[model samples]
Target chain A: MKEFKYVITDNEGIHARPAGELVKLAKTFASEVKVAKDGKEADCKKIFALMGLGVKKDQEVCFKVTGEDEDAACEALEQFMRENL
Target chain B: MKTYSGKSVYGGIAIGRIHVYKKNESMVRREKIDNPDAEMERYERAKAEAVAQLKGLYDKALKEVGEVNAAIFEIHQMMLEDDDYNESVENIVRTQHVNAEYAVASTGDNFAKIFAEMEDEYMRERAADVKDISERLLAVLGGGSAGAVQSQEPVIIAADDLAPSETVQLDKDKVLAFVTVHGSTNSHTAILAKTMGIPALIGTDVELEEIDGKFGIVDGLEGKFYVEPDEELLAQMREKQQAELAQKEMLQSLKGKENVTLDGRKVMLYANIGNVKDLPKVMQNDAGGIGLFRSEFLYLESDHFPTEEEQFQVYKTVAETMAGKRAIIRTLDIGADKKCDYFGLEAEENPALGYRGIRICLTRTDVFKTQLRALFRASAFGKLAIMYPMIISVDEIRRIQEIVAEVKAELTENGTPFGEPEQGIMIETPAAVMVSGELAKEVDFFSIGTNDLTQYTLAIDRQNPRLDEFYDPHHPAVLRMIAMVVENAHRENTWVGICGELGADTELTEEFLKMGVDELSVSPNYILPVRKRIRETNLEA
Candidate 1:
């Protein structure tokens, strides 16, 4: 499993578009992915699950990736977080 | 005759036969099925058909309301495809040995309970969406229509609150007006009716079953629905109907005229469109230009603040389509009757006079600049002008100018292409009328919003039915205000226009011409009629 952490900087943090983009990205990989905030975890592959997490700004979010292509998933998510969220 | 009252969502006189749309009959029964597998197969078939119906609605809504409002259908489609929802239906059928209808209804009830229990208020309200989708599924399964409504002739449709999909499925030719017992002015049905210029009344508890196939009149301007009127009332309505028909016939013949007076006084007749989707109707009406492009539609239509590029694309399309004719895009005029959940605006007791229009823009320069930047960038496309709504002072105009300057500097620094366009204000307040001269000195023109101006000047909330008796647009105070505003604009060498329902008042066409009013911006339906009025008018006569 590959684990990573990032703090959301955008005031409207982890909003619809980025969350939708993250879900679409996670689904492209064979690996399992999950995003969590304040110990509440949501399967990152599901758009509704990620949105329901309601990760607001200045809050820390953790991502866990497993199975094949986990490295690729982690790299893509990190880049997305920097560029979007 | 039975009369019911509701909020007047759109203004007109609709006299027609009834076309009651029974959207849901709610006849779910708890009978046992002989085989669980058969019941499940029945549900699977219903689900497939529901998906197909939903897809059609999604595409239509996308065209009608743009991408954001249409996202509800996407979420609905996903809900239909969710494993949990399907599993709940299958399990209930398998375990209880019940009919698919019972199982489906139970699933909706059970899931709604869960969503209603959520801590987030918005999440709680999403129970409505879950119920909306479930109702669609059950509606399809029960052999209920997925909107195959047919009326051989024109009629007024009375219904319960119509779903967005159901509203989209209505035949434009068949529907004359809409009357519902439960809905708000901001509901999809109300907005669509207003956009189509169909009369509508909402929030009335009229029993459609009792009056089905009866003659009725939806008096939208008066906020009342009348069923099976007496001869005298019927005669009055017939006269009104003939007048409307005559007006339409007269307007149709002047479609290509230059909206000029018989005495050779020329004025521009423009359309006030809410969004990019309205552009086709604007063009179809041959409006000389777009006078009031309500930019708040962008913010109102989105789940979040619309990106600058998103706004720019809409502005560019409208400007390019108008092709050098003025497209006066109004900055965000949210608040009052219009609310945006994303804007986080504080609720006010008197929103019409509260933190709206220039107040919100001046305070939240961030929101203001994003719109300005997009508008400025789109100015390169065609004759684009910017207008602000509810400006009541010269100081406010100065502050707004500073922000516009900042946005211009930023755009220039970024090497963006934009033309210097005319800037204007909406003369909608008494104070705006009082300061018209100082305000005109700061802008290129004025466009009066008579609805709010009348309400504000008279201190009568026209939306409140109790005040309907006192709501008079013809009151001398309003006429004087218009005359004063026009006089002030001319003195400043600036053009002034009226983008209000009063602008389409044919009786006042010569009055406005006499006042030297340069333009009249109205809804698309009024464009041709107002143009014809201009053609017949003799200002000097």
Candidate 2:
């Protein structure tokens, strides 16, 4: 299992575009990815679930990846958040 | 020639053949079947075809109305694939040992009820969308096309009534006007025609088929439709149509200019729209953003009510399309001038003043909460503001705040997306004006609805043409109210806007500027001329 935490930078929060991009990138690897904010967790693979988390600007959200491609998933998702989110 | 009258919802002249529109009624009949597996296959095929149909509408709507309106079809597509929606259909077919039609009928009923039971006026309307999709699938299963109005050419759409989805799917070029056998002046189709600047008449008793395929002259201003009018009447209608077209062309030219005064003062000029489909026209007119999104149309559009998710999509789409421009959504202001059958409101002698706007919403907390939730969810997308209509006292505003807080807490607990949007109120009541200083402290801004303010203050029925003389929009008392509201709003460090018909009056442009009005939200046609007048006037003078 791999875990990492990142704070939301954009003022609009984890909006549809960023959440959709993150989901698309997470789906590339054979891993179970979950995003958690303020003790509530959301599956990273589902766009609506990720959006439902409502991770706003300046709030820190954690990502947990489990399975064979956990390492790859963690690295790509981090990059995705940094570049897109 | 024959002439029939109803209500004049939109004022214009339309000359065309009658195109009687018949919508696809869901023929979902229960039948016992031995092959549950085979029924599932049938359901799957119908669902696939439904998705394809939606895809086509999405693409076409995208091209014409832009993405905000098109996103609704996407939401419909999502609803089809929803776990609850699909699972219910599957389980019903698998367990009941019934045909696909029976299972779909029951499942649609179950699904639609979830929305219909919801409290929000805007959200409950989603039940119709569910029913719409279900009916389309049923149409596919029954070997017929969904919403394929076989219009030979451009003609007036005559129907009992039109659903919101049906109105959205209409080919604007092919439909000249909307003439309905039964519909309220505040019906969804009537509101559409008004926003589209198309001629429309509702509640006409004339049987359209009697004069079907024959020419008709629709006098929207007078609320009359003349079937097969003589050459003299036709000539008059033609001349009026040409002049209207010329005026439309003239307005189209002002789509790019900034609303700047000659003296270098700039004010945000915006338009009040009835629904999301009206956004394209608002964009074309180059209005900053929607000043008023009258969400009552959502409630009026559906046979039942809408759901929160459905309302969220609409509000979200409008906010996103505005792209950081202000989208002030007024909560459901039904009951007064608007007649909604579902509300079961007792008819009153003075319906306009009896019960409406914030009064109904406040009493119906569930409906109010749903609207607040959808609005808050949409606030995550772009600049969104909420305005309460017909607020007279500080207590109503306070009660609204409590409800807003409750909705916010609920959203926060669910980890739902929301943003703190600017809140405002429509100062339409004379009592609000009398106590402007006290009321201004409760809101972020104030929007003066001068029409209602004038009506209520003067005690004149706006609907009666006989009271036109007494319907003084420019009376000193009304002007005093505007100035007082503006002063009070400014003192509280909030802005004031005029969204009433008076806001568009060129004669009052300088007067409003002098009154310290922050924004002028008016009809789309008046934006340019108002801007031109503002440019010519010097506030100092």
Best by lDDT: 1
lDDT of 2 at B28: 65
Candidate 2 local accuracy as lDDT?
0.79
Q: Considering every candidate listed, which one attains the maximal DockQ?
A: 1
lDDT of 2 by residue, B262-369 (tens): 666778788888977677567656788778889998889876667675577678778888878899999999985586787788888888878889999999899889
Task: Provide chain B TM-scores across all predictions.
Answer: 0.57, 0.59
Clashing pairs in 1: none
Interface RMSD of each: 5.2, 8.8
What TM-score, to 2 decimals, does candidate 2 have? 0.55
lDDT score at residue B351, model 1, on the 0-100 scale: 85
Candidate 2 lDDT over residue span A1-85, tens digit each: 9999998765456754556557667778889999999999987876545655667767999999999999988988886675335
DockQ of each: 0.16, 0.04
TM-score of 1: 0.58
Off by over 4 Å in 1: A1-85, B23-25, B34-39, B63-69, B117-125, B150-154, B248-541
Q: Could you give the DockQ of candidate 1?
A: 0.16
Candidate 1 CAPRI category: incorrect
Q: Residues A1-85, candidate 1: write the lDDT tens digits.
A: 9989998866566754456567778888999998988989988876556766777768899999998999999988887775456
